[model samples]
Target: MRALIAIDWGTSSLRGARLSVTGQVLESREFARGILTVPPGQFEAVFNELFGDWMAAPHALCLISGMAGSRQGWQEAPYCPCPAGFAELGQHLLWLQADRIALVPGLSCMNPDTLNTPDVMRGEEVQLFGALQLAERNTATLVLPGTHSKWVQVEHGRVTRFSTFMTGEVYALLSQHSILGKTLDLNGTFDETAFLQGVDQSQQAGSVLNKVFAVRTLGLFERLSAAVLPSYLSGLLIGEELRHQNVPPAQGPVILIGSDALTLRYTLALRHLGIACQSRGAEATWAGLHALATKLTNKP
Candidate 1:
């Protein structure tokens, strides 16, 4: 029941926390070095540098979830097929450096649309489990937004199915690389009005591809300022992503888990579309890691 080192190591960054048995975070730290940046076989070294001060004792266990379990990470922890839960995840924990450290296996499920095409996720599973726990719901639809947004459906405490969206990635590519990139001002502030305008437009006729061109025309006519175009573009992408998912409003409040900035836009967009939403901080990942750690320690 001693404190555990919970690390959420993703592709771009690493977040670590020391959590007591009761799941209270005692100390935490973040590092810019994600799995991609960590040199081969140096995961432990980097982990130590970021969290050595809290190691305290050899008995302390480190539980990692994220890209660290990826093929290019410290070890390739195999994906556990869905309908998975904490028990299934516990059964597949990959031990690294003996029982002192472990990696939480990611979950895999068939693409609902393609049937045979597999879709997988690493770190977000932990967050989903945590979000489920925080919501205290046995069934719910959860949304985790980031570079790649995820819409996951959980039933009876197990993940039934989920889908990923390239909303953020698409927005970034369009705003920074595509023809729309020229008029965008990355340093601009968020404009709720302009963003809502895009959300409104998303509901109207026209494909997202064709609609994006309006960013240029609007800016050309001085109707949408560079300061607010970013928000509008964000709304457009998120709105379309949601619209495409076609999640019924009857699913109740969609549980949202992620940073405030990203979730804020999603919340606004979802609300504008008349969908209910509830939110929790990223600490859900810690609560989830702690839950799994408890299971691991109590196992015979």
Candidate 2:
């Protein structure tokens, strides 16, 4: 039987899995992928080291997603346009070596001309598809939250268009690394009341961060604390998300895939906005890997 390998190579780590044609996992492993933390220029060596045991096997077919196809990895593949389905990925394939290896291109959105801007997602495509498969429907909405959160809209088994919120990364930098970081408490939690307040402020403001520090101010004045951070953060994101609702969908379901805590917070905020959102937990990345790998191999 041919072995299918799926890799989710991100900014910080590399996750790979071997699976049967039926999408059943055989083995999986992870390796540090921080371009800086690992060898200066030995991605292939590091990948080989981590998956060597699995490498010595039957017919090998590999499909990679994420930073592995970045400018630093094997080869950077181009981004495929939206309204993309399964085969859409097939078109953007980048050969890492030969028939034994290929990388799926990331999803690109927005018109690049006029400097309108663009948002690209590399590794989340599989998760979106897997979530759609689980739903087994023609249309679905998926939220994959991380450093940069993206809300994907999939229809007819194709990724039409999506929106990205630099929420998480911005929050991290401001709350932990920037000058504003110095004001955050180590054990802070989400503040529900402050969250709604922050959401209101963000929605009415020019810049998202224009009033982010108010959360801290409310806390320092003995008016807020641990319970407000999450809520405040949620509000900020929720407020931003609302901007996209020029015309709301028929009010269908929202499937969030990511860490439990993060998605749960999104669920809470969406619910507060009167939108029903279900938390799907983090999509099994390894399972997602196998699904893409199997698709690429054209195996049942």
Best by lDDT: 1
Error of 2 at 156 (Å): 1.1
- Give the deviation of candidate 1 from the true structure as CA RMSD: 1.6
- Cα lDDT of model 2 by residue, 195-297, tens digit: 7766666667476655676656666776656455646655775667665543245636887888887786677667766776666643456556566655666
- Per-candidate total of colliding backbone pairs: 0, 8
TM-score of each: 0.95, 0.85
Q: What's the lDDT of the predicted structure labeled candidate 2?
A: 0.70
* TM-score, prediction 1: 0.95
Clashing pairs in 2: 189-226, 190-227, 190-228, 190-229, 190-230, 191-227, 191-228, 191-229
Cα RMSD (Å) per model?
A: 1.6, 3.1
Q: What is the C-alpha lDDT of each candidate?
A: 0.88, 0.70
Model 1 spans > 4 angstroms off: 56-58, 248-251
Candidate whose TM-score is highest:
1
Alpha carbon lDDT at 79, candidate 2: 84
